[model samples]
Target: MRILFASSEIHPLMKTGGLADVSASLPVALKRLRHDIRLLMPAYPQALARAGKLESMATVTLPGFPDDPVTLLSGMLPGTRVPLLLADAPRCFQRAGDPYRAMDGQDWQDNHLRFGLFARLIEHLSLERTPLGWRPEVVHCHDWQTGLAPVMLGMHETRPVTAFTIHNLAYQGLFPRHAFDALNLPPELWHYQGLEFHGQMSFIKGGIAYADHVTTVSPTYAREIRTQQLGNGLDGLLNHRAESLTGILNGVDYKEWDPGRDRHIAANYGPEDFSGKALCKTDLQDHFKLRGTSGVPLLGHVGRMVPQKGVDLLLRAAEPLLAAGEAQLVVVGTGSSALEQAARRLAERHPGRVGVHIGYDEGLAHRVEAGADIFVMPSRFEPCGLNQMYSLRYGTVPVVRRTGGLADTVVDADPAGLKAGDATGICFDAALPEALTDALTRALALYHQPDLWRRLVRTAMAQDFSWARSAEAYATLYRDLVAARVPPGKP
Candidate 1:
């Protein structure tokens, strides 16, 4: 299979979230499966710096793209043999703090133009119109950034099959109505059945409407997006195209996340033994400036401190337990000024029990996974969270809200699950503080029962959420799409 994986970000190059990790890992996994998979992303300064030596492949000029010809740069992804293509349009992607945001945390004013040009590059590659001479049999697009490729491909009488995966529906690439005219998208695309949503132009609709198949990060999320509650106003269309939509749970790259070989953590540990985990916990406590013995229950939270992640809910729910000195909490992430302040305030109010860091640090994240007795992820909705899986691998029991991928992955530590030795984490049904508190209570109870906690931790560590199976699933989908491709001039 010849596949082009298109994303706006890639790990070690430019990463804002899980999409970058997936873009990096999945392609490597597919290549390992003997597929000729190439990764495609913009040539941001960070990405160019991290992506090793490169050769100029080709230059492409797309109609109405407001920039010089895009220089296609070919290289190998850092630390991986997978071929990498960077659409190098300096004016669009060369400057950035993150892919989507600037240094001051504002969305880049020209995102529409930046990603629009990237989509054009994908179109050129998919249609085999560029001098690079590599035509993908299938182009897999991720999130709203690459959403326009499917639509552009659809304009041709014949083209590669397209698959679009929605990482998060909340980030639908919506622009004002004028952007449609400004981008010179075909007027036909501005209809209700096309890229238009309400009175605005929606980039995400290009993929949803034109792609041969649609996917989300998790099976539960695939179902969740069809409902009005989680759909973010696209539910009706998703329901209309339900047959073409599917969800495959995102897989973790064990090479990067496994505790036994993790160089970022304070100590190394594995499923067979967790002696190093105790040292990791002590190190974590020390780093957080908390005075706690190894026996004290330590809870960890790592992610953006945003409403969707339920950071506020976690803070509120854990207060009583922290005040009681029954547990300690350490939080690592940055988002939402209000929530960051709240977390810092909580830490200040409880000097020894609460600790908060305002930004993301990969090493600290690893330590949190390895050191914490319990991992907390009380998301209102999660597309396909990787941290819970990481925690499980590190023998850190996860307490998560039952939604999206969290629902698909974590088995509740209930009596039935415990008896069957299938319990991997604690799950709560609601997003409220009360629900999280109850789940934390359950985790604490299990933690106090040393034998049961040990059984649970071992079970968690034994679970496999690796990329081999996920890569195989993607390969199958690509094959199916190619098999079903309409013959040229016959459709």
Candidate 2:
């Protein structure tokens, strides 16, 4: 299969969240399955620097983009042989603190324009408009950044099979109705059933409405988005397109996350011998200045400190435990000022019992996974969280809300599940702080039972959530979509 994987971000070169990680790993996985996959992303300065030994491929211009000639650079993704295509439009992508946000943390005012041009680039690549003459049979678009690709391709009578994955529906790229004029899309796209959402132009609607097939990160999330509560106002359209929707759970790249050979952690350990995990725990305690012995359970949270992550709920739920000296807390992330301040205040109030790191550090993230007795992810709505999977791989039992991939992956440590020897982690229902607190209390009980805790850790470590399974699922989907379009004798 010839696949064009389009995403706004890719890991190692550029990353803001799990999307980048998925964009990087999934293609490599597909390539391992013998498919010819090419990654398409903007030529951000960071990406250009990291993606080594490039060859200039072709140049093209979009209808409305004044940046007349966007050069396409071809390179191999670092550490993998998968072909990488970079759309080099310096004025649009070069000057960035992150891909979507300015240095001040405000979303870039011209995001619609930035990604609109990107959508056109995807169209060009999908249609084989470039001089390079290689066309993708399947163009798999990720998130709203590449949402317009399916929309653009949908206009043509003959085009490649398109699949769009909604990483998160909450981030629908909406712009003022007037902004659509700048994108130079057909006037018909202004209709309510098209790109228009209420009075705004929604970039995500392009993919959801026009793509041949749609997917979300997890099966639970696929069902959740069809409801009014979690749909973020797009439930009707989603329900309308229900037959074509799917929820393939995202897989963890164990090569990077496995604890046995992780270079980032203080000590390497696996499910069989957890002695090194104790040294990692002590090192984590020393690093965080937490004055807790290995006897006390150390809870860990690593992600954006935002309301959606249930950071507020985490603070409220864990404070009582932290204050009582029953357990210790260590949080690492950067997000909303209020939540960041609250985490710092909790650390201050409980001095040696709480630790807070305000920004992301990959090495520190690994240490937290390796060190913590339990991992906390009380997301109000998680699409498919990777850290919880990382926690499981490191034998750090995850305490997660029963939603999305967390629901799909982590088996609740209920008596029935434990008795059947199937429990991997702890799960709680509801988004309330009390629910999480109660779940944490249950985890604490389990933590005190050394033999049971060790058994649960081993169970978690033994569970497989590798990319091979996910890649196989994707390969099946691609073959199905492509087979429908191509005649039996046609290559």
Candidate 3:
């Protein structure tokens, strides 16, 4: 099948979260399965700078928004067979230093317009038969940034089947209804069942309503989103289209994350050769300025620091954990000033016990995964977390909130019920600080048992959640969607 993937970010070129990792790895896996896959993303200055010496394609004009002629840039993904198409529009994309951020750390207010243009451009490109005669049989749209692509495809009678995957529903691309006039959408599409959402234009709502199939990142999340607690106001719509909704768990790129081959960490070690991991732990302690200690359990967390991440709860439980004097904490991420300040304050209060690196460092994150005895991800609502999977791959037991993909992945460590070599990680149902403390205490208690800890690590390392499995599932879905479009007698 010929598939065109539209996303806001892709790894190695641009990234802020797991969406980039998925956009980068999924295509490669699908390509390996012999599907013709191509990736499309905005050619932000950073991306263009990183994607050096790529060939440029002919200019194409997007009809809905005037004065912006979308230029197509072509490149081969490094070390892969997949082709990449980057939409170049400097006036809209190049104004910012980061892909979606201004110099002052504020999100660009015109993000709705920016991504709307990108979505329309992707739709136009997908529908057009090039002079070289290239067109996609299916267009896979990711998140709210590319949500309008499916909506636009629905408007076009000749367009291919569309699939929209919601990585997170909380970030629906919403703007004032007046912006619909700027979008120049058809009059019939302005209602609630279309792009409109409670007097505003919601890109996510449009995708959910118009796409042939809608998917979330995990089965648990897909079921969770149908309820008021997790829906983010789209529960009713999802409930109405329950038959079309599916949850396919996200997969990790083993090549990028495998402990056997990762070059980012200080030492490389797999399940069999686990001795090098201790060196990685010491390296992590030095990097984070935590006092190097062999006996103390080093807990690691690598993600955006926000209430959604349960960083607030983590903060509230920090002092108690430090006072227990059983473990040390090392956190790596940047988000939400309150969490940052809280992390900094904790680091100050317990100088050697808490280490806080207030920004993202890919190398440091890998070291932390390799070094830490336990990894914590207490997200209040995670769509499908990749960090916990990474931690598992590195033999770091995850301590997570039993929500979304976290619940799908981590097995709660039960002392009495757990078999010798079966337990993987710790889990808690509540998002409160006390729940986190209890979960941490349970993990700490397990850490005292050397045989149990080793067994848990080995169990986690043995788990497989690679992209090849997910690619096969996606292939089945694509075939089904394509078959629906073809006539019964047609070849």
**Index of the highest-TM-score prediction:** 2
The model with the greater lDDT, 1 or 3, is 1
Deviation in angstroms for 172 in model 2?
0.4
> For every model shown, what is its TM-score relative to the native structure?
0.98, 0.98, 0.98
* RMSD of each candidate relative to the true structure: 1.6, 1.1, 1.3
lDDT of 2 by residue, 322-379 (tens): 8888899999999899999999999889999999999988889999999999999999
Off by over 4 Å in 2: 487-491
Taken over the whole model, the C-alpha lDDT of each candidate is: 0.91, 0.92, 0.87
CA lDDT of 168 in candidate 3? 92
What is the alpha-carbon lDDT for the whole of candidate 2?
A: 0.92
Kindly give the stretch of ten consecutive residues in candidate 2 with the minimal lDDT sum.
60-69
lDDT of 3 at 101: 75
Order the candidates by lDDT, highest first: 2, 1, 3
Error at 395, model 1, angstroms: 0.3
